[model samples]
Target: MGDGLPDLPPLFGPVFALREGGDALARAVALAPEHGAGCFVWVRAYARVEAAVVLEPEQPLAAARPALLAAAAAMADALAALGPPQAEIALRWPATLVVNRGVVGAARLAAPPGAAETAVPAWLAVGVEVRRALPPGVEPGTDPGRTALEEEGFDEADTAELTAAWARHLMTGLNEWQERGFARLAGRYLGWLERDPAQAGAARRGLDSATGDLVLQRPDGALTRRSLRAAVAEGVA
Candidate 1:
């Protein structure tokens, strides 16, 4: 916590910090192989909260992938704690995160090499970036479609504190998944997930426990699925 650096918990492995221009996600992925589980890497940037965590799962990739949802849920929890009381935050299925209707952050996942849906991955790296503040001279609400923590009334949202909060929440979410069940984790995620107001009664969304896919159920019982594995392949979470 000194000098406002991220203070990671004891359960985590080695933690690395990158300069403003470095990519936290890429570096974390690179470290995942050698550092193994619980390795954390982050960029101490001026305008965003950027970080990633390495994990080794006991379950197969399919089952382990729900960790992405846990990460997303963790982000929402982390923000809520530091943002204005009762501030609005939502998860856009798969990866995107919204703050007061503007895209503020996102999470991405990386599966280990040679990983298959049924295989237990050697490691997985989950990276997240949140707009902490705009560069000096940038005006808030200049673009309604994008936002940052400072612009959203999160006066107490220090980058280091927020990052530490996220890591703690992520660990708690995963532990709940392992001990209580995926249902436990899914509930927290779904609670923060965004829904189409126009199609309120026309569709429903649920997560497939085994594959971590998003299932959109139509009123007529027709279902559309979004693959978590596919998102990992496409380089997003």
Candidate 2:
């Protein structure tokens, strides 16, 4: 692992720039106990950028959902720096980044296997992967489900610059969460979600602080509590 990356904001944690052979998640998690929170593991892969950040396990993985959302918002800020056209970039719940209405990449998260509530946690890690280049013969909209920066007309950008920008934005957003709490992060993320007309009947309610669930009250006097845990486990909003 390499270190000493300047320009990455301090809250991103310690920087561990990894060679191609390293495992991104494992590398970040390994540093948690010693490096403390915000330790970052950035794995440089050809044509793709991947990274992971350490999350201390004071609560179950589910309880960290808000921070997870904050991470995604930070990535959006990074992508915006690439000069994506206005309104061209958006994030799909629970963690997919979309460009021009096509999926460009997604975020993946991992915590200690079988982590339990009240367990101070080994650490949680959130990984991000963005495709920079496309393989030959794979045309945009070929999948109608995926895309890349190059395909999106972001050829002027490169992985190094992009990764550095992401580290900064992510750290800044994390700090905001640390200072002000998850409500701020939730507001930003909730703004990105596409409202479902079908769910119009489900009165949009706020998250339950006690259980960390989103409670939707229906117009018909019915109430539904959706577990933030289950939503995050699937990793989609």
**Candidate that would win on lDDT:** 1
**132-213, model 1: which lDDT tens digit per residue?**
8887887887888998888888887677888889999999998899899989988899889888553366467788999998
Compared with the true structure, what per-residue lDDT tens digits does model 2 show for residues 1-237?
A: 434344666566667888865777677767777886778888766677778888774554556645566666777878888755663877765677887777777666776778775454677787777777776788767787788888788866677677777777777766676678767666666666544453477756555543346566888878877675676676564
Least accurate 10 contiguous residues by lDDT in model 2: 1-10
Off by over 4 Å in 1: 1-6, 197-200
Q: How much lDDT does each candidate structure score?
A: 0.83, 0.69
Residue 69 shift from truth in candidate 2, angstroms = 1.0
**How much is 24 displaced in model 1, in angstroms?**
1.5
RMSD of each: 2.2, 3.1
Tell me the spans in candidate 2 whose CA falls farther than 4 Å from its real position.
Answer: 1-6, 20-22, 57-60, 196-226, 235-237
Q: Among these predicted structures, which one has the highest TM-score?
A: 1
Quote the positional error of residue 175 for candidate 2 in Å. 1.5
